[model samples]
Target: MNQFTDKRKGMDHKDLAVEARGLVKVFGDNRAVDGVDLNVRAGSIYGVLGPNGAGKTTTIRMLATLLKADAGSAKIFGYDVAKDAQIVRQLIGVTGQYASVDESLSATENLVIFSRLLGLSRAESKRKAMELLEEFGLTEAARRPLKHFSGGMRRRLDLAASLIAQPPLIFLDEPTTGLDPRTRNQMWDTIRRLVKEGSTVLLTTQYLQEADELADRIAVIDHGRVVAEGTVNDLKESIGTSSLHLSIQNEQSLSKARLIVERVLNVQSAVTAEGGKITAPMADADRVTDLLITLREAGIQLEELSVQKPTLDEVFLSITGQNTASNTQVKKEELA
Candidate 1:
């Protein structure tokens, strides 16, 4: 099968993995994650999606024990994040947005060091290092310094380093952000394999399609609040009715079609002059039939017409009143 086709395999969810209730984190005057609740079933991928500074990274950090929470509670494998942090740490692996692998060390050396730090014996560390190298398709370049690795390879090694102990839960923060398309697919496959092996994952990403493709459930956060949360289809349904798009033969016909559709549907309608198109939220499937008849009776010629469900981006925009693409770009610049 081709690489594109290969990346479309099904994902399996098996068990309850991570749970959070009223997860809150504050840094001085800033409340990064405010009253967020999450439940990541075992062996499933749960995605946390938001614009930059949406508390995604802060949430992950608190969950991973890298930062302490000001209030609320989080548990991993039944261990409390605040009190039983060490145990929680042992049960989860984390890969941050940026590659955290040691650039001065070779892939093999990096893995070995991480394994030893996790308490593996010297010989066992070597074994674990080799195992991860092979699993991440990095065996051929195992001895290469991380500085020499390509962006994708470095990401793989960074992920591999996080998995040296094979923790049951993994936190991936924008794991595919900087990789090329092929490498992004490769990383997605790697995540799928981890889930298949009964690992629960809590992923935070800015890519809408990535979450739509991989997450069993998605939570959209804005301004440190979860603005919306549901399965992809559920979220789409919550946004409102499907949009009916019509292509008219001319600008005059476009205005007529909009008036007809608005009268029939009793809803606000938009007409685009550039494409001579009209769009409106359709409440019923029969609305299309009625709309076509109205347009025909009005002597308007439509070149094309179709209905489409709201995409994740649309849902986000509806809830937050901000465009995700522009927000992401702004965040990138701030990070830079």
Candidate 2:
């Protein structure tokens, strides 16, 4: 086997599909990317989340070989990105924040062009284009011009074009930016499908729920550095606590329910009128069952109740002290 093949063969003991250390980049006087380290495993989705100007795009660009990092190193499946960029390119596909398809071309035409560029024969390209168009629910609109396609359809085509060669790794740079809720959900489904088929994906997004829903692990970046990195539960637990939320059937019941919960859990409960919801800190995991039994014995009828860890929005605000409201779904124009 060649040396590159040997290095990959040695990867049987390595858990990471992508690895980087002390990555940095600069644009004129601005340091777009600071020292950043990343380790993403094979066959899983890793999310990088941040607001605009957070260096997410710059980091991904370095990993994808579009831009070189000024310092440190990056590797994909044992291939060094800077040194073996061509080999690394052979293993990865990238879908940027903006749709990469030609606006005047048809969906099938776009995908076929991509497939052909990846070294597929014309006939093979056509077959692969047909398959991807069907997979991404674009078969009916396969022959339709890109201008006629909706924003969502075009986004799917961009994604479809990237997968033309079925590269094992994918870098999705804000894949759902500016998409409607339904269309974003559709894209989420497509991402899950990609992971199910054994693709490792690096996804960057400003949407908090997008990372919470899709990522096996997430790294939150701000001001060009990763402030936090972990699974959803891990990050939530870092600066926040889990809580029990209960809604009483009647407003009058909230008063009684609050007393029952506080007495049973040994914590104060705050009652809110919005949903007749009573919220309390959950210090002990086992007390949830006890609280339920205590409320039942006191004749409290709950309209709704559940235990929840803190949301990603809360974590983001706590870490950066920045208003989550200011983070809009950004386009490529907004990112560095």
Best candidate, lDDT: 2
TM-scores, one per candidate: 0.77, 0.73
Top candidate when judged by TM-score against the true structure: 1
lDDT of each: 0.77, 0.81
lDDT of 2 at 97: 80
Give the Å shift of residue 168 in candidate 1. 0.7
In model 2, the clashing pairs are none
Cα lDDT of model 1 by residue, 1-336, tens digit? 011111112422223466677877766566777888777778779888887777888888888988877888888877888899989889999998888889998999999989999999999999999998998899999988887889889889989998888899999999988889999999999899899998888898887778877998888876567777777666655445577788887766566677788899776666543665676666677767887887888888878888876554455545554555443454332221
lDDT value, residue 3 of candidate 1? 12
How big is the positional error of residue 15 in model 1, measured in Å on the Cα after superposition? 6.9
Each candidate's root-mean-square deviation in Å?
A: 7.4, 8.2
